[model samples]
Target chain A: MEKKKIRNDIILAVCVLAASLIALAVFLCVRARGSYAVVLIDGKETARYSLSENAEIEIKSENGVNTLKIENGKASVISASCPDGICTAHRAVRYGGEVIVCLPNKLVIRIDSASNGGVDAVS
Target chain B: MKTKNIAFIGLLCSVSLILAYIEALLPPIYAAAPGIKLGLANIMSVFALYKYGAKEAATVCLIRISLSALLFGNPWSLAYSAAGAVLSLAVMILLKLSGKFSPVGVSIAGGVCHNLGQILLAMMVLKTIGLGLYMAVLAITGTIAGVLVGFCASLMLKYLKKV
Candidate 1:
């Protein structure tokens, strides 16, 4: 019984570790610092701004209000009237593929580099 | 349904909802990741599945998601949580039926599936494949959270029998 229990433990440990390793690899692959910020309201592109040009944007969406601030080549939600305020809680982001989503407001702020092409026909 | 079953299921639903509320109170450990949650409420889902069977588990999950959404979240969050719950529950049921794993294994599987479901929804809503770039991070977090949740459920199963 003890041996069988050990086997179960080993099997589970291996599976979880293997999956995590793969995930870590993928996580590294899709992340890089970017030079622009894109905002989407209700799944539609509403605005785009350069990371180099520091500015604050106030977005009035269907659900509520959010204020996105870009400064020091980093973008963040400085304030939001949404109940959760999760987007505001997110740290200043300067990485490509990093996203801040205000689920309550149906708002998304995505970061991408200005040096490379990112927005595609599907977007 | 019998009166006793209704009361029992209701009690489980309330407990899960309370867990959800408590989870919301906790701060996110990672500033970059918002959706990573302990999913402590899933303890009851696993219990319901093991004790009263899949149908009871499904009922408990459905009520818990709906009530918790009404109490704490907006329409968008409601939609996201509902989709995640459904996919997670379906995966859990399949794992349970396979009979190859324990409650701990089932909960882990459920947790991972839940993250995938939510990620897929987020990608679609954002209209960007870049959203998937962070999925690996979520997968790692989900696995850790899954082990914690699964551990709790296994312990609870040892004591609690019926939903």
Candidate 2:
């Protein structure tokens, strides 16, 4: 192994790492558009509701129950029958790709930005 | 391939499979987020790519994913793993052939490519481009995991060469 090659590799690694970090920083600051909440039960999506809509949904499964609430363009799990209740404790999510998971109940509510500002064609 | 080379590939394959099994037993530390892992098996993949060449590295990666699927994953996971491994291996081979980056750099690129490949597949299956948001956090985590895996591979390669 040439020492020169290793030095070059280190430089390349730093450049890529810096580039990825900038991308992440940009993602954090960007405002999401046309976002919605997706309710997944056992890894399969059960329903999708827009973030622009304010409503409450009670998702009951054999595992347990979780009440997902969308209000003021943000989503949260306000209540659940699961033992952990980590989802309920989580902060309300307004950004795309954020999620509230009721693991004990196998319920996942993830926030996704339609970004295109149009209704999803999957309906 | 020589008999000795074949044996080395087989050895790396089994090692990678064992690493995959061990990784499966770890808790999902990220809680609500899934698919985060130490990727210990990738150490062998990176090492083999740098040491034995692309053919052997590809063999190591394929066998690890296949054997791990048999041990503890379903068909769905097998599909994702295969896609990630293939994409990662392809990028790693390209980087190696270029000799423009060290093993660590190549591993980092491989790690990011693996996540991207899986995310692209998920977007296609879900029929929505929304999955791009998930890639942000994953990108950060993937870089960390890649660096750790790469550093370990660096040490392992040094030892193997001496042996």
Give the best candidate by lDDT. 1
Write down the worst ten-residue block by lDDT for model 2 chain A.
Answer: A114-123
The residue-by-residue lDDT of candidate 2 on A45-69, one tens digit each, is: 7899988989998888878888888
Q: Please give, for residues B1-75, the per-residue lDDT of candidate 2 as tens digits.
A: 889878888988988888898888876555424456678899999999988899989989998999898889867
CA-lDDT, candidates in order: 0.78, 0.78
Model 1 regions more than 4 Å off: A1-17, A26-31, A61-64, A118-123, B1-7, B28-30, B161-163
Model 1 lDDT per residue over A24-115, tens place: 67756865677788887776777889999889989897778999999999999989987777788888888766778886677888776654
Show where candidate 2 strays beyond 4 Å.
A1-3, A32-92, A96-123, B31-33
Worst 10 residues of 2 chain B by lDDT: B27-36
DockQ of each: 0.37, 0.29
lDDT of 2: 0.78
Model 1 TM-score relative to the real fold: 0.84
Model 1 residue A43 CA deviation (Å) reads 4.1
Standalone chain B TM-score for every prediction: 0.92, 0.96
